[model samples]
Target: MGQRMKPFIILFLNLLLCQSILAPPPPVDYGDSELSLKDVEQLLELYDYEDGLTIDEPQVEIGTLSPIRHKAAIPEPEHTNIFSAEHELPPQKPLPRLPLPPDALGPQTQRGLPTCLLCTCLITTVYCDDLKLEYVPPLPKNTTHFYGRYNKIKRINKNDFANLNKLKKIDVTASQIAEVDEDAFRELPHLEELVIRENQLRQLPELPSTMTLIDASDNKLGRTAIKNEAFKDMDNLQYLYLADNKLDHIPVPLPHSLRALHLQNNNIQEMHEDTFCNSKDMSYIRKGLEDIRLDGNPINLSKTPNAYMCLLRLPTGRLI
Candidate 1:
């Protein structure tokens, strides 16, 4: 009986030891602490001595954000308009009128033959016809206008019209006048018009500053240079006729006041860019000038690239 009781007591002691080892510890209350999957798996493995533990798969969902909405929180970029930029201002008013001299209406003199009879005489006009004089006549004192056509006058002398301060017009057209002296019309300050057409002149003489018109067509000017200090100051000059001449290169730096320039039937081959640079002021006058006749001249428009036809417009005749 004693041996059987000893076996039962040993079995009971083994069951009590197994229960003490398998019991879990008291749960600790850690406030607001996130537990990782690895930590939870470690805790379950530490207590799973009799049964194995398995974990489920974790679920995750993702969303995308817009880049435009992120930029809207920041300040917008600066903007500007590109159309309102300019460098110069427009012209405001018109130019003033040119002022004439106080003594612009004075009388003029003539210098030539004394025997030349005055065929006809008006208030300010004089006509001498069929005069076979070899030279210009010494005009009467205070003679403002003179007409000496159909005569055989050859050359013009010095101080010819010295005292003719009011000489506004002179007609020597259709005469046999050949040569003109250097000081032909020196002191005629108010002389405006000169008619020397259909003559045998080889070149032009020194003209005056107040000459507004020059009718020098059908002359014999061959290879002549129209150079004189008097031409530089002719601000009132408008008409210039160099037709039927033998000019090869047209004169450069034309007067700014010239409204009509005729170079027809000349032997001009080429023209420079500065040829019409000085005539830019004629556009302010009436009609603003039109016509540039290069018909008779031998010019290459391709070689002369900068030529502007607007600078050759004239008031009286075409720009030939």
Candidate 2:
């Protein structure tokens, strides 16, 4: 019996010793313990055997995981606003009509002789017939006047008065003259008067400073304003005849030496208040001017009251 008990005891002791060695040494409380290779292996094996857990396939929908659609949906462009438009402007008016004189009918006339059989010979005069002559040659060196009335000359050409330094007068009335070149009176430095009435002149040609009188009536001068400087240099100009022309206003700053001014049958409607501002000096030399014909201008009464009043006060009186 003792021997049997001894054998049981030995077996029990052996079993106790094995248990103590296999048990994990009472878990070391190392706050955050690092596991050894054996512990990690044990944990993995335990997790593998623990559950019937299966991984789910990632859930996917039609629009999920796509970039956010932030852009605005595009619509078609409108065409109504591009087809609306507007209109345009108009044009200007035309100028008035004016006639010209007839042409010279014969050869160039001699400087000092009667230009035609019908003309009378005079010491200082020239005369020519109505023919289609191109130019009128210069007057003779000794000639002092010219008379080429009723001729068909179109222009007063170069050297037309070349050596007529003593020329004092010219009479080219009733001609077919459309234009006068600036050089037409170039050499006539002492010319005192010019008579170019009864022609179809649309505008007055420039005159020289030596001229004292001008007779340019019965022509078509369409409502043109005479520049003050036009006669400023003509210190000798005393008489000016602008009747039967188309003037609408009195030219300002008239010549200081002017003793008479004729403006009959004009289209004149107004007179500038200062038109005679410079004429005060002329009264002393000529004892006041002779006439200011405003007869045919019906509008002058109302449009130029001051001028009418001033004219009435003149020493020689007015003509309206």
Candidate 3:
């Protein structure tokens, strides 16, 4: 029995060995195949050759990206307002046809100058006085004198008389004006007389060197209002009215060219010896300041006799 089983076992062992030897070898792991430095150089050379090909040659048939397209521009919207049309102010209509004047009826009116029912043929002098106007009216180009008194004008803007080159005089008295721009009348080259009286002006505006007369009364003007040597430069100044204001003392050493000074009702309590006359010599008189009104003040004329010695008359104030 041992001899017969040995041959069968040997045969089976041989068959297994033969099958193992005959079978194909297992596959090897050839991970991601990386190109070597030399292979990369060869690939670049091939690309260069392809790029150098002529237009008719198909170098390396490849697809292309689509071109970019720009969006269309939007149009501007129509004029719109947050406020309703009914609530907004209506467009100001043009003036109705005016009657014929002695001058060229249509041509004179076409000057675009404002018309006053009360104004006469003399258009140069626009007299809108005492008409209870709240604002100053636009004047003509050739206007020389303009009067807009007893109105409710609160402020004097710089653009009030902007380009009126021929304008010479402007009187806006008793108009309840509280504010005045510093350059309101500074640009005018020919402005000689300026009357802004009986208003609420606290600080006086810069006076033009060409100014000859300035009337600022019935308002508030204190000590610091008049800059030191304020009126010294005005060589041609003659009449200066500063009555019924808040001045504490007389603007002493007043300009020699000053003719009339209406400081009647102010806060002036005293006047220096050189206020009107030269202190070194009392005989020296101030003939130009003859029309001085110092009434309604706290100072006494009798106390400062030397102060008014050169003057023709004394100031009208309490003397104790």
Candidate that scores best on lDDT: 3
Give all candidate RMSDs, comma-separated. Answer: 24.7, 24.6, 23.5
**lDDT for model 3:** 0.73
Better of 2 and 3 by TM-score: 3
Tell me the spans in candidate 1 whose CA falls farther than 4 Å from its real position: 1-117, 228-230, 278-287, 309-320
| RMSD in Å for model 2 | 24.6
Note the Cα lDDT for every prediction shown. Answer: 0.62, 0.62, 0.73
Candidate 2 local Cα displacement, residue 20, angstroms: 99
**lDDT tens digits, residue span 178-263, model 3:** 98888888889889999988888888888677889988888888888776777777788899889989999776556789988888
TM per candidate comes to: 0.55, 0.55, 0.60
TM-score of model 2 (CA atoms) = 0.55
* Residue pairs in collision within model 3: none
Ranking by TM-score: 3, 1, 2
Which model scores highest in TM-score?
3
Tell me the deviation in Å of residue 219 in model 1. Answer: 1.4
- True lDDT of residue 104, candidate 2: 27
Residue 1 deviation, candidate 1, in Å?
A: 99
Lowest summed-lDDT stretch of 10 residues in model 3?
102-111
